[model samples]
Target: MRRKILKVLALAPFALLFTSCEKKISHEHREVHWDRDMCERCKMVVSERNHAAQVINKETGEAYMFDDIGCVILWFKEENITWKDTASIWITDVKTSKWIDARTAHYDTVHQTPMAYGFSANEKKESIVKDSEILNFEEMSKRVLQRGR
Candidate 1:
């Protein structure tokens, strides 16, 4: 009886640890506070250190976030994203974490993220394109070299 009790006690900590380590997804509409330095979009508590963000049209304040670039593009395409009149688009560089234009983003076919696209901030790096020229789905397909389904 003593040995059985000790064994149960030893296993208790392991059970607790596993439960604590599990990811907690909230289905309720909880208020989210988003900081650019922390989360770029959705404003959820982002534990993923590799997260990135983009804001289109600072004036309009349109923005989006992604766990990875692929997720960002996937969300955009999946939702058939559309922009309002007189707006700009911006995206964060996974490396530098700086905001850049969305238009000039360099699309890489092969990346950890399927929608991996990046922009250069300065002359040294190619920044993502801003709202200087907005492209619709038709134009984007040609730029990314993929057909919009």
Candidate 2:
């Protein structure tokens, strides 16, 4: 009827306004998406067990994938010329397939952990040091190994 058509027409503008005001979620934080064949860095087969890699991005969903923890740092320090907002480092547990934040992990001087970076081969446990305690490559090298060649 004409009344029904008028009711729908009146509601249409309000509906469009609500839809236009809806907040859009960014895809920047989505998990790493890539071909499952090989690591984009080391050229090794992407293994779900042994070594692992991850992609980090922000704002615009620009992802950068790597083969090892070392590679991740190396890529950030070298390859990625593009601007990045924030980065998340994904480290696989030596015993478990679970991923942990590498930026906030305890480093052991005796136990060898898989995919460990630099002298952190001796990682004791996961996230033992807390995020604030972690140091960058240059600083960690000086702290863990001392300043030298």
TM-score of 2: 0.52
Q: What are the runs in model 2 whose C-alpha is more than 4 Å off?
A: 1-35, 48-50, 81-85, 108-149
Q: Return the TM-score for each candidate structure.
A: 0.37, 0.52
For model 1, residues 27-102, the per-residue Cα lDDT tens digits are 2222223442233323334333323434353443444444343334445555555642233444444446455554
Report how far off residue 82 is in candidate 1 (Å).
2.9
Q: How many residue pairs clash in each candidate?
A: 14, 1
Model 1 misplaced regions, further than 4 Å = 1-51, 57-62, 84-87, 107-111, 114-149
lDDT by residue (tens digit), candidate 2, 55-119: 56544445545545555555554566354335554555444545565555444333342334433
Model 1: per-residue Cα lDDT at residue 109 = 30
